[model samples]
Target: MSTARVWAPRPATVAVQIDGVRHPMTPGEGGWWEGPDLPPGARYGFLLDDDPTPRPDPRGRRLPDGVHGLSQAALPRLAPLDWPGRELRDGVIYELHVGTFTPEGTLDAAVARLGHLVDLGIDFVELLPVNAFNGTHNWGYDGVAWFAVHEAYGGPDAYAGFVAACHARGLGVIQDVVYNHLGPSGNYLPLYGPYLRDQAANTWGQEVELSHAEVRRYILDNARMWFEEYGVDGLRLDAVHALRDTSDEHILRTLSRETDDLSRRLERPLTLIAESDLNDPVMFRPRHEGGHGLTAQWSDDYHHAAHVALTGETAGYYADFEPLTALGRVATRGFFHAGTWSTFRERTHGVPLDDDVEAWRLVTCLQNHDQIGNRAAGDRLSASLSPRRQAIGAVLAVLTPSTPMLFMGEEWGASTPWQFFTSHPEPDLGRATAEGRFAEFEKMGWNRDVVPDPQDPATFQRSKLAWDELAHEPHRRLLAQYRDLIALRSREPDLRSPRLGDLSAEIDEHERHVTFVRGRIRIRLNLGDATWRPEGEEEALFATSDDVSGNPLMLPPDSALVSRTIE
Candidate 1:
């Protein structure tokens, strides 16, 4: 028997369409409606009193047709996950969008590529959002049905298979989930209740109401479903700053605590990684330290500093990262805006980073989904920077104490652009999206005419990874360099130490060189045209240029070298 239920307090009467038959539902005490049980494998939709329109379930687990279609009872329960007890910090992370990770563009196809990641030395695989959206192709961020697995990605079963496949290959899975807002099209939350606060305005569609009890439960339940039902190892919370609430206990802390309790129950590490723009260390600080106790968060300061030093782009977010001293600041301290003046915001931006926070709690990446995908054409750093500079970026991101993330195809220096693409069927939404894409790039000085139409099939086709390029020339060399660096990171002790306070940096502004001293290793990079030499008897572990070897280390232009002190 299949039971159909829904929460609809605003409607005078509610009925559920089960197997094409509309059955009346009785209103219960908790603002819920209970209908008669239907046969198993039944597909259903809700009818709110004389209203003729069919509505999808608010807590629907599976959307087989599309977001607009009837919600169905998902088949056979997922088998228990055979976790290998691998933690998120055990090794490095690889972030990929399932749609573009393979030519097939499905979750199972992504599973077929796990062996490649395992060979590339990835311990965790972070997937972009897989929630059901109103399209055939998307980066998956603009999802409407929070509980549904995208039908294009093979729905709920395929996601489970993807997770199991990762675990089978000794990989932990982390999913990106947007708790801040839902996508504009096919949004059903507002139909049931006051899901959005009328007073609150967010650029990313309607903001969810935190004051409502059931709405909070809706999100928290979604969080639990990923771990409990789908067997995802961790969650990467998307754009947490947009979640507005004034409750005594913050939602983030509450989620962290709930995740911890679930972790204990599951006997595995279930964690939360926040994509916070706040730049506050309190996101990952200990609860005893008056923090929210989230496991970790992404830090963009490192990327900003590295981008300025490597690409020399002084536009957009790269404006404040002048003099290249900003890189020096982030290497020693976790944040360049650590209680300092920001030329971008025209005032102080970040709170003072506490002394004791572990550097690894902050995840740093040279290329991430947003960093590349949100660009006018998703051109990677490898597209513009020299091969030598690409190697340098790799060394800094991975060798640093902080946890590092590798975007898909980053290992072989992929040449494909990960441009934003969508297949919204509606003419109005499609037009609006294309216009918005063009308008967004105008501020960055991008050519609006050249901006690919997101609704175009060619746009999605162009973003697929080019696996054939990995065997030739510079791509092969870059792949080798990445493999060696990952091996070295495991072989070295100081580089893996998470204590942020112990690391220090010395920058030579005139010569354009920065030497970082952490643990027993010293990482020196020469960004100038003149060759720079190391002062002492240090052993070279990795060098981007051939000249940065031998007794007197004469580093070449755009070179990065890591050396250990001869004690």
Candidate 2:
């Protein structure tokens, strides 16, 4: 037997409909309603205030049908996992979208590929948002039911199995979650209470009403559910800067404090990584230091600088990152824009990371969902660069002084594009999304004509990774290079060191070569048209090219090498 509880503040009446049988719910304290006990797996929904149509539970654990359909009773709890656990520091992350990672695009199907990640030396597998969204396929961001797993991805049971499988293979899972705004469709929270702010809004529709006590609890509880119930190691908080809250204590601070308490109780390291555009170091600072105290935060500066240095595409936000020194600055310093001028926002942006802060606290990537998907044609860096250049990009990404994350197929340079795709069932909403995507790309200097119609089913299908590419020529070679670098990182204690003070780089602007030192190791990237032959006796540990062998090393243009000085 289970008790039904829902928070609907201003509703004159509230009722619970279990298995099509209506039962009047008694109004309780804190604007909550309680209903009679019911058996598990019962189909249920809430009916409020003279409205004949029932709304899905705001805290539903399962939605077998769809986001708009009746919610199923919580699935039976799985046996506790025997996870040995992994921590965030000095770890590598691989980010993937559930719908496109595999052909089946289900959690069960995704499990079949865990061995590949384990083999590739991935420490954490970061999945894009998987909460219940409208229709069959989406980017997973247009989720309305935050509590329920998307039924298309094999529901809650499959989610549990996927997490268990990862732990079994010694991998940690980081789930991306959105709390700033609900999707355009299937959002019934407004009918129940002030879930969204009335006037204020972010880039995505209305801002969540964090001012309300219950609403704050709702967001906090959802975050904890991933760690406590789902057994995830971490949560990649999506767009935390957009979470506008003017309360005495911000929800992020409260979440940090609560998560710390929960982490102690669970006896495992539970990480909170924020994807923030603010470039604020406060997100990862300890609460005692008057900061949010999150485990880490994504830094886009490295991605932008690396992209500009490699591709020479300085359009839009890449304008300020044009100089090769930008890459060097990010290599040594945590952020390239720390208290610097921004050509994109037309204002000084980002605070410098504190001296005491560890470099590993900033998670950076060369290619990610947003960087690749947001492109006009959803083209990847591999679409333009040669195999050698791709290797250089990998070297810069993996060997950087911070925690590094690789996008879905980035290791082998998967040719498939990760375009923005959605399946909003409402015709009007679909049309609006497609149009808005085109406009946004056009404003960012992208070719408007190349932007795919996000509503088209073909768009979703085209974005899927072609796993067969792994067995082929250049793909196999690049994959090996990535594996070698990861292995080297794991073997070298200096590579895993978190001190930013140990970092220094020599940038040859004309030669287009940059060498960064960490302990006794020297990593050099030759980005020019001519090869570099430095006069030195060094033990060559790893090089992108095979020709860079023996005492006098030859660094090929558009390739990188790692070596230690002969003492």
Candidate 3:
């Protein structure tokens, strides 16, 4: 016999609809409803008030049919894993969507591709959120059930199998989790306790109630459950800036302390990486320092500066960063807007990283999900830049002082676009997304008619990785270069050092040339239309283009050259 409990704070009466029969539930204190002697495979949904529609359990452990049908109490086959001893800062990470990572579009299939990643020299595999969303296909941000792995991705058992496989291969698995808000469809959290804030709002609708004690407990408990039960090495917190909690002790701090305690008990490394737009150094500072003790956070300034410098497209946030000097600042200081004015916000923002903080506290990337997918056409760097330039970007990313991360297929410079796509079963949800997407682009002066409907099936299919591209000539060369660069980063002492002062960047804005110096290694790039010859004596190490020659080096347009300074 199994028992089920759900929190319906506002409901006057709650009943469990099981096999065409309604079983009245006992309402416990604090708006919780409980039922005893329920079967494991029982088909039950909560009936609130006079409403005809039955809602799935808000804290459903398993969703058998996507997010629309029965909530099963089915026990997961594999027990939660015990985390292996490993530090996130010590390894390179490769982020991928399980559905698009392989042709099979399942966790088991993704396991088959782990050898390829291991061969590529990546230490951690950061998966997009696997939580149950509204449909069969999505970017995974619109997650409804935070606990249950999506049924489309082989359910809870398959997820355990995938994690176990990764551990066996000596690779750490990082799961992306969404705590800011839930999706529109199948979002029964509001019907429950104070899971959502009726007063507060985020860019994506209602915000999670982190200030409330019970709500705070729920969120913290969920985070700990994944680490303690699932053996997850680390969590990539999605859009942390949107998590509004005015409590004296922020929820992030609480999570950091809990995770730290768990890590000590398990005798393994556990990390928390936050996806934050706020460039506040407090996120990386230790809890004892009167700051939130997150391990690392995404550095958008690095991407914005690097992208604008390479692509020369200064639209949107790129407007704030047109010159190479901004990129230089990020290279040396770890933040471009360090107490400086932000042109985008028209306000002073971001605190500079403390002198004691290492560069690994920041994670930099050229093409992340938001950077690539939010584009009007989802065009990747390969779509805009030539193969040589793409290689240059990769070298710059890996050689930087901060920890580097690569999106799937970016190593080979795959030409396929990863556009925003979803397969919401509800017609209302589909329509809402279509209208909302167009409206968003309209503010940026984009043609609304030209924007592809995210609800379209073709949109999702187009985002899948083209595994065949890996075998192609140009792609193969780029892939080899990436492996070599990662290998070099791992072997070179100076490259792995996260010291901020050990890095410097020399830039000629008019010539469109930038040279980054990290210890004995100096990497120079010609972003202009003309080739440049080096002034001092330097031995050539690597060049994206083959045009450079002689002791005084010459770099071709949209190319990069790396050399070691001769004494």
- Winner by TM-score between candidate 3 and candidate 2: 2
Clash totals in order: 0, 0, 0
Instruction: Look at candidate 1 and tell me the lDDT of residue 567.
Output: 83
Index of the highest-lDDT prediction = 2
Structure candidate 2, residue pairs in collision: none
Question: What TM-score quantifies how close candidate 2 is to the native fold?
Answer: 0.98
How good is model 3 by TM-score? Answer: 0.94
| Window of ten residues with lowest summed lDDT in model 1 | 73-82
How does model 1 fare in lDDT? Answer: 0.84
Q: What TM-score fits each model?
A: 0.97, 0.98, 0.94
Give the Cα lDDT of each candidate: 0.84, 0.90, 0.84
Ranking by TM-score: 2, 1, 3
Best by TM-score: 2
Q: Can you write out model 1's per-residue Cα lDDT over 358-411, one digit (the tens) per residue?
A: 787888888888888888877898899889998898887787678889999888
Report the lDDT tens digits of candidate 3 across residue range 343-428.
99999999977667789989998888889999988889998887878888888777777889999999999988999998877898
For model 3 the local lDDT of residue 313 reads 96
Model 1: how far is 195 from its true place, Å? 1.5
RMSD of each: 1.5, 1.2, 2.3
